[model samples]
Target: MIIVIVALGGGVAGGYALSYQQAQQSVLKTSVPKELAPVIAAYETVTNNYYKSVNTTKLTDGAIKGMLATLDDPYSVYLQNNDKTNLDDTISASFGGIGATIQQNHDSLSIASILPDTPAKKAGMQVGDVLLKVNGKDVSKQTVSKAVAKIRGKIGTTVAVTVKRGSKQATFSMKRQKITVDTVTGQLASANKQVGVITISTFSEPTVKQFKATVKKLRKEGAKSFVLDLRQNPGGMMSAALSISSMFSKNGQTVLQVEDRNGAKEVYKAGKKLDDGFKVTEKTAVLIDGNSASASEITAAALHQNSNIPLVGEKSFGKGTVQNVGEMGSNKELKLTIAKWLTPNGTWINHKGLTPDIKVDYPAAAKITLINATQLKPGDKGSDVKSLQQMLTALKVGSVTVNSQYDDATQAAVKTFQQANKLDATGTADQDTLATLAQKLSAQLTKDDPMMKAAVDAVAK
Candidate 1:
C-alpha cells in the first residue's frame, strides 16, 4: 500500500511495505526482542509513512526545514543556513542589526527595550513601542521570526520601521551596524546623594567582569547605598549569576541551591575571594519586575534570603528550571530541561514568582484626587480663616500672614504644588492630600537624615 502526505506546499508518496521493513530492521539493530515485534512494527509503520513522504523529494533543504516545522514548537524549529549562522553570531555577542530587544505581542511585535548607545536608542525607540510596519510593508500580520528576518540585514544597511507609541505613530530609518551591548550599566543614583544604581540587563559571559568593575567605580564615587536594578533582565549564564552574587556575599555561604530530577540537591557557595573589596551595605535594594527571570531570580533570592537587602517593585517571572544544551549530531542541538533551582532558604520559586518585600504601584489615572483641604479666599472670615491660614503656612503654601486671615497668595501657592505633583489642582488637599504630604516629608527627611548625612559627610573617609 502507498501513502501520500502533503506539507511545506509540496506532496510526496511512499510505499508502506518498503518503509515499514526499513524501520523494523533499524529497531531490531537496537536489540528489541521478538515478542515486542508487533508493537515496534506498528510504531514504525506510522512514523515511516511520515518520514518517507518528507524524504520523497530529492532530499532538499526545504524538506528538512518543513519536517522540523511540523513539530509546532517555536524553539524547536529548524534554522535555515543563514539563520544558523546568525544564531551563532548572536550567541557569540556580535550581530549586525539595530540594537533592540523584541518580543511577540499577540499577532504583532513590540520593542521590549532599546540598548543604550545603539542605533535603536539613537533613533528614539522606546519601550512599549508597537511595531506596525517594516520597510513600508505591514508587519502587524507577520510572525516574530518573519519580522526578525525583515529587520536584520548586512552591516551598513538601513531599514525603515514604523511604530506606535501610545497614541502617536512615528517612523524611523535606522542604519544597521555591528552592535555590542554592554550587559552592565552603573551610575550614581543622584550625584549629590551617596546612593548608586546599577542596571544589569543580562548575566552574559562578560557580566561578572563588568559587574565587578562597575561596583568598584561606583564605590569610588562615594556610593554607600546601592539599588541593583534587575527589572527587565531575562537572565543568561548560571556562572555569571554565581559570580555576581559573590560580590555581595561573605565566604562559606550558599548563594543558591539546585535539585536534579532524581531528587539530588547541590548548594552553590560564594567563593573565598567573594566580596574582596566591596562592603555589603545594609541598605541595598534589588529592583525587580515580571520580566526578571532565571539567573536574575537566583541573585534576588540569594540577597533576600541570606542578606539584609530588600526587593522592591513587582513579582518576578519565575523560570527556575536549568536547561542543558545537548548537541544532537548533524549540527542540531537539543535544549532539555535538567534541573530546578531553589533559593538559599530552600523556596522553590518556579511558575509562582518571587514576591516583593515592598510593593508600590504607579498611579493609574490622572483624575485621582490625593489630598483635600479647604481654605478662605482673599478678604474672608473668622475662626475658619485662622485655621486655614495656619495650615497653608505650615505646608509652605505662601509667605502670607496667618493671623486670622484669608489671602489670594496662599491659595495660589497651594494650587501650584497640587498641579506640580499631578493632584486635582483644586488648591485643596483632598483625599489624596495626606499621602502627598507624607511623601514630601519623607523625601525632605531622607535628604538630611543623619545616616545619609554621615555617608555624604564622609566623602573623604
Candidate 2:
C-alpha cells in the first residue's frame, strides 16, 4: 500500500496520554503580586507599539509558558487549546484519528503500534514499518507532529499511507474513525490453567473498571492465580493505580506518600471501599519493564509492599512526581508538578527506578517457521507437531505437551479449540484451525514470549 506523506495542518503529541485525578482540592488563592509590573509593561508596549496587529492570546500563552520554563520542570506546562484537547482525548481513551503510534527512528518514522480494531490495524500496518509518504507527500524529513497532523483528518475521510516493510513497499487507504482505546487486556495461559494474565497499557479513567471486571470474569472462568503485566506502560492516573492496588492489598495499606514543597507529607492508603472479589492467589505476580513509569511504578510498589507480589522483569522508568492538571480559563490548562510521591517504604523513586523482586531479562524467541497442516491425526510426529504444540501451549489450550508428538491428548485439545472457535471439529490441527487459534492467541502470548513464560513460571513454581 502506498501511504502518501503530506504536510500536516496541526501538531500532534507523540503517543499522548494523561494520568490525572479530579478530587476535592484546597486551592490557596493568591492575588497578583506587584513584582509583575515589568511583565505587564512589556505586554502593553508590544500591544500598543508593535509594527503589526498582535495576537494577544498567543502572546499571553507564550508568556505563561515562559514563566513556567523558569521552574526547570518539563512536565509543568501551559497547555494551549489543542494541547488541552489532546490531553482530554488521552485521559478519556477516545479520539478521532487514525489509531497508530509512530516514533522517529534513526532515519525514518516507524509505526510502533496499530491500535486494535482501528483503521490502521485493519489496513495491516505493522510495527517497525518505515513510513514512506502520506497522500503522496514525502514525510521522511517531517517531524512526527507534522506527520501526524497530515495523517489525521475528519471522520470517514480517507488518507493514503505508504510504508516500507523489509524490501517491499505497500500503500493502504485508511479511513479515520473515532477510536476507543482499551488499556487492559487479559487471558488464561495454556502453560498453567491456574493462572490468568492481564496486561495494562495505561491508567486511564476507565482502566480500573476494566481491570476489576476482567479479573472477576477470569476468576469465574477458573483462573486461580494472576499475572499483572505493566511492561512498556507509560503510566496514567494516580487514583486509578491506587484503586487497582487496593484490590490486592488489605485495608490501611499505604499506597503512596506525597511530599510537598515544604517537606509536609500526605499518605494515601488503600481503603476497604472496593472489594475486588477474586482472592489474589499466593502466586500472583506484577511484571515491569524500563518503559513502565508514574502510576505503573506506584502500582508495582503498592502491590509489592502490601500484597508481597513478586515483581518480575526489568527496572521501571522512575517518574514519581504528581502533576495536577488545572483548568486555566476556557479551553486552556495548567499542569503543575505539585509534589513528589514516594514508595510505601519511604524510598524516593525519582531518577532511580524500582528494582524487581525477580530481575529476569527477556529471553529470545525460539526460531520456528509458521506451518500449515491439512489434518493431523493421533499418529503425527515431527517438528511441525512440536510447533503446533508450542503455539497451543502459549494460548493456554488443553494439555498438549510440546514433545513433538500429536497424541490422543493433542487431538482432543484441537477438537475442543475448534469447536469453541466455531470451526469444523475434525479432531485435527489443520491450517484453518491453526489460523483461527492464532487470531485468538495473538495478544495473550506468542510461541516464544519470554516475559509471559517467566510470569507463568514465577507463579507455577
Candidate 3:
C-alpha cells in the first residue's frame, strides 16, 4: 500500500513493541542470508553472554534501523507505532493536540506556527516559542517527535507546558482536543475585494473537496480572480494534489512525472472529465514559501505549467520526492523514498526547488493588534494605562512598567515609539499616537498576508 504523510512523533503503547517484536521474529526467519553469519553470531553472542538483562526485542528493532541507516537515506526511517499513528492522523488532516506545528531547528524544537483558534492559540502561544518543559519535566533536549507525543493526549485532557519566548518563560495548562485542520480556506482580500485568496494549509484527502467548495463560494460572492496560498504548507497526499490540480488543468493534461529507483517512469494526467467548476477566465496566482513541499510543489508546478498561473512569494522547500509507505508487519509500516517528482514540463524539482515567476519579499514584521484609544498626556491612572504599557512592552519598548498609573516615563516611551515608527515625535499619548500604536499592533496580527496583496495586483484587471 502507498500512503503520503508529513509528521514528527515517537513510540505508542506497549502493544506496538510486541507487534514490532513479532515482526522482527518473522524478519529474522527469512530476511538475513547465509552470507550474514557474522551478524547472526553477534546477535547470539549478545543474547547469550551479555551480563546485563538485554531487551532482545529492542535490539532487533535497533539492528533493523541501523541497517537502514547505513544507506544514508534521510527519508527512510523506522516507524514506531506512534509514528505510524501520527502519519495516519496527518493524512486525515486531524488529530488530538494543542494545534501548534513544531519543527526541529538548529538547537531546539520550536513552534513553527500556531493553527488559528486552536488550543495552542487560545492559550496565547506564538510562533517561535520554544518548548521548555512538559508537565514540569525539561523537554528542551527531546526530539521534535518525542515532544509532540508528550503534548498530544486524549480529548479534553489538560497538559501543562512551559514555553520560552525570548528571555520570558510562561507556563500554561491547556486542554487537548481533536484538531480538525482546514486545508483550504477562502476569503476575499479586504484590500482588493475583486481578488479572492484561498490558503491551502496542506494537501490531504479532504483538501480537494474543501478547495472546490471554497472556490465556488468565493466566485458566488463576486471574486473575479484568485490567489492560491500554499505558504508554510508541508504537503500531504499526492492524489489530493493531482485531484486539486485537475480543477485548473484540462482533461488528460500531464500534471506530473514520477521516476522510481529502477528507472521506471510514470506520468500522472488529469482525468477525462475536468472540474468545470473552476472558471478559466479567472486568473490565478499561487503563493509558495520555504515550507511548501512535495504535493504543494506539485500543485504549484502543475497549475503554472498547464494554465500559466503566476507563482508568487519565495522559492519552495524543494522536497520534490514521493514517499511510499508500505506495511512491514501487521501494525508496522515502512516508509521509503520511492520516486522523484518531476514537473509537467519535465523539470526535476528535487533539492533545487521551483522558483516563483514573481519573487516577492514580503515584510516579516511582528503581528499587531489594534488597541483601544487612550487619550492621556500625563498623570493618568487606570487599567487602560496598564494595558497600554503591556502593548508597548510587546513592541519591545523599554522601561515601561505595567503599573496602572502613567507617569513621565510612560510619555517618554511613547515619544520613543513614535520616533521609531516615523510618526510625529509626540511626548503625549494622543489619538494619533494611539492610532499609530494600534495600527502597528494590528500589523502583527494581519493573517491575510502581504503576499496576497502582490498576488491580487498580478490578477487585478
TM-score of each: 0.59, 0.63, 0.68
lDDT of 2 by residue, 1-461 (tens): 99998764433211111100111111113354545655665676677657899999989988897888788886676655444522213311343576776554334566654544566655545555688899889997565666777887777887877787665565666667886666778889878888998877677777888887788778888887889988766676788888887777777878789999999999887775543443344468888977678889999998998888888889988888998988999867788899999988898999888898888775421223334354566788976687677767766688877788988888888888898889899987765675565445554434456777878888887
A best-first ranking of the candidates according to their lDDT comes to 3, 2, 1
Residue-level error in angstroms, candidate 2, position 228: 0.4
Q: Which candidate gets the maximum lDDT versus the true structure? A: 3
On a 0 to 100 scale, what is the lDDT of residue 458 in model 1?
29
Alpha carbon deviation, residue 224, candidate 1 (Å) = 1.6
Off by over 4 Å in 2: 1-30, 85-180, 274-282, 363-447
The parts of candidate 3 lying over 4 Å away from their true place are 1-31, 85-97, 101-132, 139-178, 272-281, 364-448
Clashing pairs in 3: 366-444, 367-444, 367-445, 368-441, 368-442, 368-443, 368-444, 368-445, 369-441, 369-442
Q: What is the lDDT of residue 322 in candidate 3?
A: 84
Please give the clash total of every predicted structure, in order.
Answer: 10, 19, 10
Predictions: Cα RMSD each:
13.3, 13.9, 11.7
TM-score sort, best first = 3, 2, 1
lDDT of 1 by residue, 304-399 (tens): 876757777679988888756555445444444578988888889888888887764422211122112232355665654554454445456657
Candidate 3 residue 337 C-alpha distance from true site, Å: 0.8
Residues 228-304, model 3: lDDT tens digits: 88876767688888877877788778998998888788988876443444534479899997767888899999999
Q: Which ranges of candidate 1 are over 4 A from the true structure?
A: 1-18, 31-96, 101-114, 117-133, 136-158, 161-178, 273-282, 362-461
Pairwise TM-score winner, candidates 1 and 2: 2
Tell me model 3's lDDT, rounded to 2 decimals: 0.72
For model 1, the run of ten residues with the poorest summed lDDT: 363-372
What global local distance difference test value does model 1 have? Answer: 0.62
